[model samples]
Target: MSEMIDENAGGRVVVVGAGPTGLLLAGDLAEAGVPVTLVERRHAGRSNLSRALVVHATTLEAFDARGIADDLIAKGAPVQALRLFDTAVVDVSELPTPYPYLLVVPQYETEAVLQARLDRLGVVTRHETEVVGLRQDADGVALTVRDADGTREERAAYVVGTDGHDSSIRRLLGVEFPGHTVVASVMLVDAVLADPPSLRIATNTDGDKFAFVAPFKDGYHRIIAWDQSHPKAESEPVDLDEVRAVLHATLGTDFGMGEPRWSSRFHSDERQAEHYRAGRVFLAGDAAHTHSPAGGQGMNTGLLDAANLSWKLAAVLRGRAGDALLDTYESERYPVGTAVIKGSGRLLRAAQIKATPARKLRNLAMHFALQRPLVNRRIGFALSGLWVRYAAPAGAHELTGHRAGDVPLTGSPSRLFEALRGGGFVLLAPTELHEPAAEAGVRTAVPADGGPVRLIRPDGYIAWAADTPGAEEVALAIRASGA
Candidate 1:
């Protein structure tokens, strides 16, 4: 971690961590006209190990809202579907998303795109900067940071911690990371394959061991294997030979490795912060939650965290809403993060079951349950994150007080979200009735076949909607939401 910023500089919303989550939040904050300074413990624009490889549909849609997914796709691979080859080769293509297959992009490239976008939005990140601690009062939070050379103190109206699992911010806030760790430790290696296997993502089982491979750019592949029974010599560095041996033992054959790029050992831990906020400081991404990489959900959840928090932070900064809006961040996201951790952990347990008639029966039941389009849609909804619905406070109106699920809109702009690009509140009025919205100071967009009033938030969810022929009720709901 680098030194803190100078308190006398100016008012800045400090963001800790320059990873994808931080960059995305910074971009949103900048676009919302908030003065944001991102602090990273390393040099800026430095690419680290290419770890995460899958971008969920929710993340893709979130990036689409930011208009940066195309370039990311060009820089990485696109997986259109996932196939499970246990007992039967089941094609999970009919999942309930426009994006059924995951996006196979290296973590480094994803960060690059996010950083570039943040730069375009006029947000500068300070590298070699780390927050040592933070103190909060009635006004704001003061952060102590250590730079490459020295240390200093910086004061900010707000702080966001997007750091990894061992978050300094979480510690400063005294939040508990509650969860259990997996028994077996697994090693992951990224290598240039001499004969790269034609696999986008594969799970192969050999005897009691398993190897999972995911392809990446430049003929590199990330491989994972677990052989806890075979003890290794202490202090011996992991080499290509050892990696190849694990591969052969787990996958029945080794495709051969060129030069091993990166390798690390990790035991899965399913944990999430007790809370995401303390005084003027907030938490996002891994700082808020973490879990096993069962379905490649860590990065996806982190990205969604950025998306969810960014607009709300902007709302508070711009004075479009009250501090109460910020409180909803934890209420809305914490359960989702917990669900991801639990759901993925459950799947991992199911996968690790011994192959027997009983295990087969259990797997069959799971498969059958997932075979239903509605059930699969729910799973996809959970994975894609569209299913996240905030609990509206008591007495809040229905349509304008909660998020609107994506509904088919027969309109001029086509999709239901074409009218909400500026990240501002919008009031959709019936074309036949051009009455003023009830109380929300929002731009008016008439649905082509307008029959109802729809008030959408900047995050692409309908705050309050109604089938009424006018916008007055919708406006009233927006006002109820503190618009």
Candidate 2:
């Protein structure tokens, strides 16, 4: 760790990790012309561990709004729908969105896409660098960092901690990470198999164990199992032999377990930081919440956290909004993080319970509930995060609590997101008034295919939609989005 102090260093926003959350936030900040310096303890590139696999539809839309979904598709596989099974398989189609199922992409590939975007935005991540300490007064944050050779100090307008569960920033601030362990040790298996299983892989369960397998490369699979009361072996390489045994016992079939690529064991834990922001220092992703991977919410939630916070940070850094805008980072995300932790706990218990007669009866009842189209759609919405609608602040509007899906035009679909690419408020109007709307700092388009007027926010949600409304309605939406 370097120990040289340059406390007067300034202008850049110091980001404390280069994972997906940090990289995505840095990209947005950099694109907004906020000088950003991202620091990471590890060398640049994705970790070998196969952690998160499912990218929910909300995240897909977030990526698509940035024009990166095509690149993501090139890097991973796309499933049309997720198949749930208990006594039988239930297919839940007719989900409200265009993406009805989760996109199965490795976390590394997801990072790769974001990294490329970061490169395009001219943001450089300082690898092998660690944030040792930080202090904030009324003006800005003063941060101390150490690299391989020596220490250096830099001052920044704000700091964001995207570091993982044991975050140094969170520790430095003395924020209590409150929660309990899920009481299960899980083995993760990463391997390239000669042949792959045809099972639909989100999460699978049997007696006393939970199994999850996701495809990575053409022949690679990431497998994980939760063992409630298994004995630990002392071998250093994570006891690949034990991992194979657990997979074989639970799945009741051969994994085609080829030479292992990477393997590790981790205990399930559900924890969240007491506060996401303390003056100039803020937290996002796992730095704010750590939970079981039951719903594949860990990385997804973190990515969304980055998305939600970046716009606010950029707004304040650019002096367009006051620091009070940044305060909403915790107000909007803390409850969502708490809900995710609770939701994952329920799903973990539901999936891994020992099947007695009573358990079987409960499973049957759940299956019956899932059989209804409406119930299945609701479950899909929950799993995909489309059901989450943030509360609008006072005097917002009547169109406050909607997810802003696509609306079709005369011959094609008009995506509400196209208008929100630059992360600002937009007001759509009748074709006749497109020029008038442009004077209000709202980008005007004719919707070449002839659709109704719409309004989109920088976060890619529809702020307002109307049937060829006049300029007065468009002005109201602009005010609603705080333009």
Candidate 3:
């Protein structure tokens, strides 16, 4: 038996997998004064071969809450429109948020920003340590992990597996990940294109092939190409010639692509765990759900999952809320995961239509729908994750569960997201209500326009709101939120 290390002194959280999801969750917890240990299987260094390539508007807003959005935005190109097929487009320029476009950057860049935050928070990340076994009881969870030295037991009050699709924590928890593979033998590569496409994001599909190209800040372009007619096994080696052939077939040119930095082949799966939580153990990111790469939502969704669960976990461990508050994590995120799976699956199926007539009809239908401003905005919002809203309790205000965008405030932190940087809730209300709101363990800010008193959760979602809220009524809502 491996020796056990009892580190559960102060409700320590052990976050498995140091990917963006795990890193963000750990940082959030640490920022909230929660002791968190981040463990990763990989060695102590960042990998350049990151799969996720775009950060959506919602994710940027989440980063803004942590004061890191500007750093990440400076590292990527802002794509205002996403082009599908030849005619259909999802325009995101008109979104109401401060960041209205998708920031196209490598996943490593995103991870770097989160890792830096973790470092500043004094959170320790144990790389090269892999979770091999897990067992949870009513009080806490025991994780068996292995590193170069040997296997040992690590204890934590709560465990979150932000590890990718094949999560060790989820597997040890005996959870069921039931879903199907959506795309097979998809080839991905990062290379320098001698003749780059004019569009920031260039994507097109012939009847038999599909290709997408988006640039990186370092001058390399990330390319994803699929040839349905000649489906290669994922184990087959992908070369520049094969990539060029598919690009040429779909985009009518290879754009002088060469000097491949990295290349790989893999299948995309649409899967979600049966439940995100089992006792003291929980799952986030790809461990909880995964879907097609269409819409660049995979990383974005996982980041949001971390954002939603972190504050709740902090509140529970800090004794501000009851354990039942933790249950809402899965309840709120599962539906969003399901929606992404279905929506992305529809996109992949549409893009994979092999028949010329079917392809033409798909393009025509999409083009027509996108031409309508409402339809275009809806699709853009969905893709950017700005349309996500949790279910509000009965009798709750209309704005409950909806995201509180960077609304202007009358206080020092002049925006709602800025107010969230203290790792607590914010009550935006009339100046008279500030006194009562302060007692609820939340920062108080007067709304610039003098609207209804709205209580915003740490994650930027509206928790409670009322046009005419008494002090006691506001206090009750805050206490219910465990703040």
Best by lDDT: 3
In TM-score terms, which candidate is top?
Answer: 3
- TM-score of decoy 1: 0.86
**Which tens-of-lDDT digit does each residue in 1-483 have in candidate 1?**
112333344336889998788988888777666778899887755686565778877677666656786778787766654433243222335655455667777888899999888877777788988899789887778889999778888788889999888888999899898887753556678777677655556664433455677777577877876655553443445555666776776455677776777776666678888889887888899888888777778888888888778778766665567898889889888888988888888766765665567566765675686666677666666555656676765764565434443434555455544445445566666544334543344555666554457767666666766665444455456665544
Query: Candidate 1: where are CA atoms >4 Å away?
Result: 1-11, 85-92, 192-199, 204-208, 231-252, 255-258, 355-376, 394-419, 431-444, 448-452
RMSD of each: 4.6, 4.7, 3.4
| After superposition, candidate 2 runs with Cα above 4 Å error | 1-11, 81-85, 88-93, 192-195, 231-236, 394-396, 407-414, 431-437, 446-454, 463-483
Clashing residue pairs, backbone N/CA/C < 3 A, model 2: 2-150, 2-151, 3-151
User: How does residue 207 of candidate 3 score in lDDT?
Assistant: 57
Q: How close is candidate 3 to the true structure, as a TM-score?
A: 0.97
List, residue by residue over 95-120, the lDDT tens digit for candidate 2: 67766667777788899999999898
The RMSD (Cα, Å) of candidate 1 is 4.6
Give each model a TM-score.
0.86, 0.88, 0.97
Candidate 1 vs candidate 2, lDDT winner? 2
Model 3 per-residue lDDT tens digits across residues 381-407:
888898899999999899999998998
Runs of candidate 3 with Cα error greater than 4 angstroms are: 1-10
lDDT of each: 0.70, 0.72, 0.88
* lDDT for position 11 in model 3: 81
